[model samples]
Target: MDIQHVCILGAGTLGTRIAFQSALSGFQVKVYDIHEKSFELSKKMIEKIAKSLVSSQIYTAEDIQLALNRLSYTLNDQEAVNQADIISESVTEDIEIKRKVWTRMGEIAPEKTIFTTNTSYLLPSSLASFTGRPEKFCAFHFHDVFYSRVVDIMPHPGTNMELIPILQDFGRRLNQVPVYVRKENHGYIFNAMLLSFLGAAGKLLVNQVATIEDIDLSWKVNFHVPMGPFAILDQIGLDTAWHVTHQLPDANSQAFAALLKTYIDTGKLGEKTGEGFYKYTSK
Candidate 1:
């Protein structure tokens, strides 16, 4: 199918970024969130990011204006999915919520619309079944676009193999490096590795092996990377990190979950909220 109009469901952190990238790539973008207020917030976020891109010289004023012009925000489900060639779902990582959204999408979306999920850890196989279009479903996992530009495309057992190249080309159009995953792996390839690293880092903190500050410094000095595991947790949001930790079946995982949950409960939700493992007073 010749994809043109892209509908992005959910306007949270990742959703807005995906919408921006799609619009920048010259796709007609439609954004939908369950709550009208949430969708409004996403619009503000998109505007903010567009200005930042201009200031950073990554995009020009005309470029930002053109991209914004291609984007539309809507609350009507049928209106959002109607005539859309690609529907990218970027809701929270809750399985039940994902299933519910997919069920609705199946009911409202056109038959030829390609369905993709932006879930980090959940398997797309079960979710695809809920969509009533398993063969047309796949996981198009993306990292934070500011730093990471790689997207993992993992298909379920029922997914059509012919759709892989088309999705890959779509990824390239959005200026992302698409990595195709052959097997059905929860978290795909990159995230699986990242989660393991995060688990170990959480263990070190919980076990009192090293301080968070020192551990972060050690990794930075050695690997020459911009951020450490704790910093990454901050970027991922404490609530999100807690959700990931809560799913693990280990004592260390439980401890990590508790630690993150404490911060979340206290209203410190990472960079988005100003504080998490560390405080971010400024950008």
Candidate 2:
């Protein structure tokens, strides 16, 4: 891959940030989504974020404009993706749907384009199986602040040796601290540790061993964790957290999943819906 034009195939939170960061790094980036509403939303979000970056002194006015100039949006998959040297798929977390998108994307893009999925759970090998060029495909993980220094790059055994450096450099240019995880497992590195911790906290809550406040303080002050499990789950979207945990098999035996179905069944979708383990607002 020549590594210039970049296509982000979703306009959700993470996708928007990825496109913005790529554009800021001087790459011609196009962000596309099946939903026109999301296309519009991401556009506004990115523009506002760019201005914030400028106001916050993260970038100069010229730098912000340059980033904006490199960005475009569309729903036509081929138009947005055909010429891209790198394609990032940030669709919802469903293996079947992801398989469908990757199949279509592989068919439309240039042969050497590096295809990647911003999947939080699915293994890299599983995703690679769906693409036309598995050798050039990988998993690129971004945390809550998708534009942050934390990043994980997971490549399958079949991934191309030549393309790895391009991705590493891409992470570096964007000020991302990238770590490569060789094997595939549910949750990769961060999520594996995160889900386990959340389980323990959930157990404490369910068992009444401690109040949410106590559980929160124990980790937040004692371990200096930025946010406690409940708060983190709130931001991550309760419905999403509930569903992923259920798939863990042993997750239902833990404190987290005991009330998982209850939270989701009751229409408490965490911060996105203004209620979950904590109350929230649309702000």
Candidate 3:
């Protein structure tokens, strides 16, 4: 599919970042959010990121303008997708919500438009059937682009083999290293490895084996990494971590979910809300 235009659904954290990166990559990027307020937030977020890129000397003001010129935003679903060659969705982590969105998108988007989800836990095959075009559906998982430049591409049993290389090329255009997952894995490669680290650290905190600060310090001191599991969770956001934990169906997982819920219920969502496992002064 000569992948030129890319439509991104949901203007939240990852969606906004993807929109910016796609535009910077020279793809005509269309960002769609369900609400007007979300469009406002996304615009501001993209502006802040662009400014940061300039301040860091990674890009010039002209480069930022070029990216902005290539990007568009809309509230209408069908209008946002229209004739886009690829539609990347970064909505909530719930399966039902994803299925509903895919179903509607399948009914509206062009038949040639490839569909991909940014789901962290759900397998692509589980929701591919809802899209009505399983051969064109797959999982395209990305970390916070500012921190990680790798994206995991996982195809369902029904996906077309020919499309894999195209998507890989698309990832490269966005300046990302794309890893192909050989089979259907719940968390793909990175998240599968990440869960174990987060679970162990969560157990220590939950069982009072160590303080959050001390545990983070222990890992940082030993590993010489800037952040620990708790710090990573804060960056990923507690609400998002909570959803991912719920995907694990175990007593230990339930405990961790509850722990995250405690923070979320108090309106401390993470960096976005200024607090989570710890406090943050910057967004």
Q: Would you list the rank order by TM-score, best first?
A: 3, 1, 2
What ranges in model 2 sit over 4 Å off?
145-147, 251-258, 261-268, 272-276, 281-283
> How far off is residue 91 in model 2, in Å?
1.2
In the range 1-283, model 3's lDDT, one tens digit per residue, is 6899999998888899999999988999998888888888788778888889999998899998999999999989989989789999999888888999999999999978999999988999999999889999989988877659899999999999888999999998888899999899988999999999999999888889999999999999999999999998987878889989977887888888899999989998876667888887744
- A best-first ranking of the candidates according to their lDDT comes to 3, 1, 2
TM-score of 1: 0.95
Mark the 10 consecutive residues where model 1 has the least summed lDDT: 38-47
Top candidate when judged by TM-score against the true structure = 3
- Scored by lDDT, the top model is 3
Regions of model 3 farther than 4 Å from truth: none
Candidates 1 and 2, the one with greater lDDT:
1
